[model samples]
Target chain A: MDYFRQAWAIAWKDILSELRTRQMISSVLLFCLLVMVIFSFTFDPGAEYVSELVPGILWVAFCFAGTLGLERSWGAEQENRAVDGLLLSPMDRSAIFLGKALGNLVFMLAVELVTFPLAAVLFGVSFLDVWGKVALVAVLATAGFMAVGTLLSAITVNTKLREILLPILLFPILVPVILAAVKSTGSLLQGEGWEGISSWVKLLAAFDVIFITVAILTFEYVVEE
Target chain B: MEPSLRRNLLGLATFMMIEAAIFMIFIWAPTEQVMGIVQRIFYFHVSCGMTTFLAFFIVFLASILYLWKKDKKWDIVAHASAELGVLFCTLVLLSGPIWARPIWGTWWTWDARLTTSLVLWLIYVAYLMLRSASRGSERRTRFAAVFGIVGFVDVPLVYLSIHWWRTIHPVVIKPSGIGLAPPMLYTFLVSWAAITILYFYLLGLRIRIGKLSEGVEELKAIQYSGV
Candidate 1:
């Protein structure tokens, strides 16, 4: 209970800061919207195959925008040596990791919330029927993404190539999450119900469990000097 | 034995073994009835593939030890092994398409093994890049160790996810365990053994280079400090 409270407190700190400035969320949201517009131009949005392309486009947008958000999320801590303060806090290092990951998850999901409906409208697909299923897939994939992203973000924050290094280190390991998410979302959008997407859901769930565990275990090493 | 003598012996052994393996592959092993001459690339390709996996496993083990022991030696081993892993992985990726273009009639198909190797290649190349980017810090070593472990742990998951994804794409190559003839099997064994030795030899060379650089850095530090 204490650990959960500590983690929540740290998450709330980030959330509250974002609420005050709205800098990270707004930029990430706008970036996601731009991705939608650019991708929409590449293919005929009215074409029959547009539905098939929507999931991949949606995931690409999420991942790219999520990468941006991740950089800022850690980059914020770098300012004023704030991460040092976090380190000096009484909470466990893994708690800090959990908190940061949770904060990232919330921010990315918020971006997804606005982007999903906008994507449906722009691409001329009615995700209205499968909205819940799509949301489920998004949440699962984003959770795993955040878990890994948070860890990698910490690792990259200290590197010379801080911004570029995250994606290079991140995307390969993230292939499974992206593949599973896109598959699940594609199927769900096609009106394939729970039974059709069950396997992908399992993969996403397994990714979430494995990576969150690994991140929690290794977070201490990344943050410690 | 002296370190130089040991290294020379290892180098000699690797050279002789590789020569013997090449001779066996080209002259001794019977050509496949189906794929013909192109099938021979399979000997080195598969051997390199195995060596790639072995190199990565070394990175994983050394990474865990690095974190556990907090030893610079372990970090050097992990970094050196990751570089060698990327090298072997590149060989696998290159030879794969060379064999595939003739046999499968495509330069690439999203086959499970092909996709997994590509992803693995990307992962370790990123590992090496991370090491280079974080050149001079102890923190860099720790971060690299963390990624080393994370990257390796992701490999099987990457493979499993890709294998499942390949079910939707019509699998171009069924990977039905090519039935090796007696001589073909012997040649493959010899090639595999030779490549494994080459990996170790290359790894030894890399580790020596890493230690020498560390020594140079220490000497420079001492000179600056007037110690």
Candidate 2:
């Protein structure tokens, strides 16, 4: 119970920081909107291609936006030296992972909230048809990406080339996650019945479980000096 | 294991010569009842592909052992094997397109084998980058081990690709499967044995060099630290 409270406290710290500054929100929102606009230039908005490309384009934007937010979370921690203070606290280190991951999830979801609806408008896709499945895919994928990214961010925090290194290390492991997410979302959008999306859901769920467990266990060594 | 001194003496250079001879023999070795000299590529191409799989398997084993023991020696073995695996896999990729060009009538297709090889290449490229990017010795070793273990996921995916997708590559030798002709089968088995020896010899030499370098570094550190 206390662990949950500690995790919540850390998460709330991030939320309050974002609320005060709006740094994460504005950049991610603007970046996602820009990606969508750039994509619109190349691919026609009125054609049937919108339905086909919406899932891929939205996920790509979310992925890039998520990276932006994640970098801010750690970057802010570095500037304030808050991670050292947090590490000095009595709470379990894994809780730090859970806290930051939950915090990242919230920020990403907030950005996605705007990106998804706006994408629907710009791309001429119906949000009413398969919004549930789309949301489910986002949740699973976001969790998996955050779990691995949190671990890699800590690992690379001390490195010279961290900004570039984190994504290179994170992307290959998360390939399976991204592939499964894109496939499942495309199926849902194409109106393939629930059965078609089930396998990919399983893939994403399995990846999330494996990665989250491994990250929690190994994170101690990552943060240790 | 007893050192196979005599066996190791017959290195990959010798076996490769034999492989080349057998390959040329395909032109003079007589045409098959069905597929012609074009079919001869089956021997070298398939054997190289199998040897690459064997190298990667060694990498996976060495990686697991390195993590378990926390020993630098195992890390060297893993790193060397992975480099060799990439080399063999690259050969398989190159030779593949040439054969496919004539037979499949295109340079490349999105076949299971081709996609699997490309993904496998990308994963190890990431692995090499991870090792290179780390600063400290211990840090690089640990990161390499983790990447090595995770990278094995691509290995199984590559091996089972034909079954998972209807690959254009033939699945000639399944364990519970049918047999092959005497001439082609005999030459292939011989070549496989030769290539296996070559992989071990190369891996052993690389590991030895790595240990020597580590030793020199340790001596230099002690000399400078005044310990």
Candidate 3:
């Protein structure tokens, strides 16, 4: 119960920061929009092909943009030396992970909220049919990625080569999530029903569950001096 | 680092040669019923693939031990096993392509076994690269242990990849396919045992060398610092 309160407190802290400054959302949204535009120019294609590739393009944009936000999310904590303040608090350290993950997830979801509509307009696709499935993929992938990402971000914060090292360490470990997301989202966009995409959904869910448990158990170690 | 274990490793190498001779005779001395002399390559190829798997499994165990104990010695063993696993995996990959060139018509295909081996190679190569790029002993061990645990998750996935995807590798020796004849089975067992012994002997030597290198570095630091 206290963990939930702590998590929500941290989440609200991040949310309130974003509301005042709007830095995270704006940066992520701009990066995502730029990617979509670049992708549009890179590929000369019919509407059919564009729609087919849009799911992948959207996720790729989300992934790269999400990294930008995440790196900054912790950048401030490290710069301000506020992590020690948070760590000294009475909350479990894993609660900080959950809070940050939720914060990042909300920021990503907000960016996607804008990107989805633009993707529909830009790619000439019917969002009504695909939105729910896309959202499902987004939630699971975000949960899985941030679950590992937050812990890894915390771990990398103390390293000397952190700026370059996090992605190198994070990407290989996150391959399964990316592969599962791409496959499931591709299947859904291809008009495959839940029955076809169920396994991937399960895979994403399993990955989220496994890593969240691991991050919770291991977060204490990562933050310890 | 013990004198007797070093001697045991030399003896292990001798036995490996003997087993290699026996394996060769079994392949060459026997007349082919179906495939020609090319089929002989299968003995070394398949046995080496199994040996690679065994070495990686040792890596997994050693990694878990290292993490649990935070001992540098176990990290040395884990590092050694990963090196040997990559070595034998390379053998499996090279021999597989060679055996295929004569038999499977092409050098490579997207078969499950071959694809998974390629992925395994990529994963371990990345592992080695990550280890090389780290600065200190503790940092290297911690990062490698985490990667070792996560990277091994690919092994079971690779093993089951054939069921999940298409593969042209013969599954006959496996329960999923027809079993091999007794002589072929016996010869394979002999080679597997030989390779297993040789792997441990090599792993022990490598770990000993690594410890000695670390010791030399410590001595150099003391001499320079005059401490």
Question: For residues B107-148, what per-residue lDDT tens digits would candidate 2 score against the true structure?
Answer: 888776677776776677666777777888888777676667
On the 0 to 100 scale, the lDDT of residue A206 in model 1 is 93
Docking class of 3: acceptable
Choose the strongest candidate by DockQ. Answer: 1
**Least accurate stretch of 10 residues (summed lDDT) in model 2 chain A?**
A216-225
Over A87-146, each residue of candidate 2 has an lDDT whose tens digit, in order, gives 999999989889998898888888887888898788887767888888888899899889
What's model 1's lDDT at A108? 88
After the best TM-score superposition of candidate 3, give how far the Cα of residue A170 lies from its true spot, in angstroms: 3.0
Instruction: State the local distance difference test value for candidate 1.
Output: 0.90
lDDT of model 1 at position A131: 83
Cα lDDT tens digits for candidate 3, A1-225: 988989989988999999999977887898999999899887885545777788779888877887777787788788669888888989888898899889988888888889988888888876678778878888998888888778767756556666666676666566666766766777777788988777677777887887888777656656665
- Model 3 regions more than 4 Å off: A157-163, B1-7, B14-26, B29-41, B100-106, B154-169, B176-178
Relative to the true structure, candidate 3 reaches a TM of 0.85
Off by over 4 Å in 2: A1-5, B1-35, B153-170, B173-180
Candidate 3 chain A — worst ten consecutive residues by lDDT sum?
Answer: A155-164
How accurate locally, in lDDT, is each candidate? 0.90, 0.76, 0.76
Instruction: Note each model's CA RMSD in angstroms.
Output: 2.0, 3.4, 3.4
Per-residue CA lDDT of model 1 for B39-137, tens digit only, reads 899889889988999999999999899889988999889988898888988998998889888777898898888899999999999998898898466
Clashing pairs in 1: none
Q: Best candidate, TM-score-wise?
A: 1
Best by lDDT: 1
